[model samples]
Target: MDEGRPIFQQIAERVENDILSGALVEEGQVPSTNEFAMFYRINPATAGKGVNLLVEQGILYKRRGIGMFVATGARERITARRRELFVLEYVAPMLAEAASLGIEPDQLGQLITDQLTAGRLSEKETR
Candidate 1:
């Protein structure tokens, strides 16, 4: 798990990102609390907590006789909600830091391009 913030919150975001990106998807069966806990090597309660956040947001809901499933429109709902976080959590802060350091636009573009290229190359090597 990544550092800072509670692990459960991070797990929640990971699940949300998966849903938004068409990974988990709408009406899909979310991983059981135990499965999530075991997969992430976290406490079952922590996994349950993460899943519960989505339940509250209507991205996920519990079935009476079964486990949790994604809400019918979870993908679209998560996409709209998460867009706000993308700017505030990532882009805005990066821009502020770039301005503070006097990094030019071209420099940022080069950095991103290099990173992406390196990432692709690294993936190819692993494959």
Candidate 2:
């Protein structure tokens, strides 16, 4: 993540990506705010901010005595939310940039697809 982006936003996005990708599933437990703070060596307040972002988005739910858990529809909700953000933030700008650079949208998309495929294959091979 770019340093210019807020740290809380980055942390929130990371957790959201994990949930969307099924690393964090519906009804599954998530690390506590303090745990996240310790794990990332950041202030607990920062971690809480990230976690609270998820809570506000209906991604994580409190369990009374227990820690936070992913919401029942969290995976789908995360996916849809990200898809919405991608269109509004990533896709539109990238399309505009492609036009500005005289690069075909299909070509740029192919490059991204190739890079992602190669990245996954490399990760699998290494594992």
What TM-score would each prediction reach against the true structure?
0.69, 0.73
TM-score of 2: 0.73
Cα error, residue 46 of model 1, in Å, equals 0.5
Question: Number of the top candidate by TM-score?
Answer: 2
For residues 18-97, could you state the per-residue lDDT of candidate 1 as single tens digits? 88777886888988999999999999999999999989999899998799899998888887877898899998999889
Once fitted onto the true fold, the runs of candidate 1 whose alpha carbons sit more than 4 angstroms away are: 90-127
Error of 1 at 20 (Å): 2.4
Tens digits of per-residue lDDT for model 2 on 1-127?
4578877788888888888777887899999999988988888898899899989989888998899998998888777877898899988998898899998878998989999999999999999
Clash pairs of candidate 2?
A: none
Whole-model Cα lDDT per candidate?
0.90, 0.87
TM-score, cand. 1 vs. native: 0.69
